[model samples]
Target: MSSEETLKRLALETLEQDADRIVQLIRVQMDNLTMPQCPVYEEVLDTQMFGLSKEIHFAVRLGLIDREHGRSILADLEKQVSDVHEAYYEHREQLKKANK
Candidate 1:
């Protein structure tokens, strides 16, 4: 394909990989029983997500990716993160119920 198309594809792949890293991080924290409300945890997540958003914005402005595609990437990551939180909470609740 054309050089422009190659660059755009690379940009999208990089963003998706970064998003996967964030998801893996959250999963690791949940596996280790790190409290979601912990200040450090919150800060790390906020910082990482903010950085990703900036990167996506840069790619969009560079014409390496479209605005809607960038948004979709972020939205998918957010939904995955939310699902992780929900699963963690549900598991915790089950543990509590089992103990009683």
Candidate 2:
């Protein structure tokens, strides 16, 4: 496979792994009844997304992926993250209803 192909594959694999991690995080927060405004929860989200984005840029600088490809990769991951957030908010609402 070409370097481009290799890079793409790696990016996908990494993204899948990270997405799973994010899901696990969301699950744990829900289990603990944590809110989005929780500082620790916010920190984790910021750290995870920021770290992944920086990694993508580093890969671009190394020529493993082009700028556009990097953006696409990050976009896919961001969408997954967004989905997790939606689930979290839904879970939070359910918790609120249960409490009331």
Candidate 3:
């Protein structure tokens, strides 16, 4: 196979492997109790999340996959993270109200 094809295949495989882990990280962050309480924890979590995003961008730029396709996939993943965050906060608010 051509180099481009090989890269594309690799990109797909990497996405398959890392996508779940990325989402899990986001879920953990959303549900984290101590993240807001600790500046260091928040910073570390942010750094790791952003780092994963950057890695995906770099992979596309490096021709690991079609740039447009990779961007679409990343966009979907971002939306998922947003949804998770929204749900997490909503649940937290409900819990707080219940305790009142």
Candidate 4:
């Protein structure tokens, strides 16, 4: 493929790979996030995930990536974010009940 096509392909692949790593991070954090009342990890994860989604949007707008791939990246990250948020809440509730 031409240079432009090669760039686009590489960009899409990088996006998917990075997003997958972030999801894995979320899963690992969820597995051990039950430490003493600490919000740092959750806050950082949310911020990082949001920033990545925004980067995907900007990459598409700048013509670095195609719209379809951009949408897919955002959608995948959004779903993972939702799942992580739900798990965090459930764990928080469990902790509260335990403490009570």
Candidate 5:
């Protein structure tokens, strides 16, 4: 395949993998936090947030996603990540609850 096509495929795969990992991590954190005493929960939460930010930064550096395009396409995804994190303290919340 052409380089553009390869890059596009790589970009899509990277985003998909990141999204899945983030959601899974969020779910685990939410599940663990259902109990009253989880000391490491906050740390795990912070790590996931940092991971998402890092993924965005990587995408920017690789030029796979332009800022303007990301603003339009990924804005909602980023917001969902933030919102899911905010709702992490809630027992019934799921990362899947965020926009897909």
Candidate 6:
């Protein structure tokens, strides 16, 4: 493939990897029973997401990735994060009932 194609492929891979890392971080927090409402948790998620969006914008501006694809990546990440949050709450509710 051409160098430009290679660069685009690398950019997409990097963005996906970054998104996966964020998901992993959320899983770890859930596993550790960390409170999702904690300010630190909010800050971390906000910062990581903002950084990823900037990277996506930069790639799109450089013609390294399609605009729609970048938007889809962010949307998918948001869905995954939401799923994790919901799972955490469900787990907490289960624990409460079990303890009673």
Each candidate: how many clashes? Answer: 0, 0, 0, 0, 0, 0
Q: Candidate 4, clashing residue pairs? A: none
**TM-score comparison, 1 vs 4, better candidate:** 1
Error of 5 at 18 (Å): 1.1
lDDT of each: 0.97, 0.75, 0.72, 0.78, 0.63, 0.97
Lowest-scoring 10 consecutive residues by lDDT in candidate 6?
Answer: 29-38
Candidate 5, lDDT over the whole model = 0.63
Q: Relative to the unseen true structure, what is the C-alpha lDDT of residue 30 in candidate 1, on a scale of 0 to 100?
A: 99
lDDT of 5 by residue, 1-100 (tens): 9998798678767776766676677666655654323557666656765676677667768888766654543555556656765676552454446734
Candidate 4: where is the Cα deviation over 4 Å?
A: 35-38, 84-100
Prediction 1 TM-score vs. true: 0.97
* Residue 72 CA displacement from its true place in model 2, Å: 2.5
lDDT of 4 by residue, 1-100 (tens): 8998888788788888878888887777678765423588768677777878887887788799878878878787879867876878888899899999
TM-score per prediction, in order, is 0.97, 0.68, 0.66, 0.67, 0.56, 0.97
lDDT of 6 by residue, 1-100 (tens): 9999999999999999999999999999989999889999999999999999999999999999999999999999999999999999999999999999
After best superposition, candidate 3 residue 26: deviation in angstroms? 2.0
- Candidate 1 lDDT over residue span 1-100, tens digit each: 9999999899999999999999999999999999999999999999999999999999999999989999999999999999999999999999999999
Residue pairs with colliding backbones in model 5 are none
Q: Model 2: what TM-score? A: 0.68
Error of 3 at 36 (Å): 6.1
Residues 39-87 of candidate 2 have per-residue lDDT tens digits of: 9888988898787778778777876667887787667766876776788
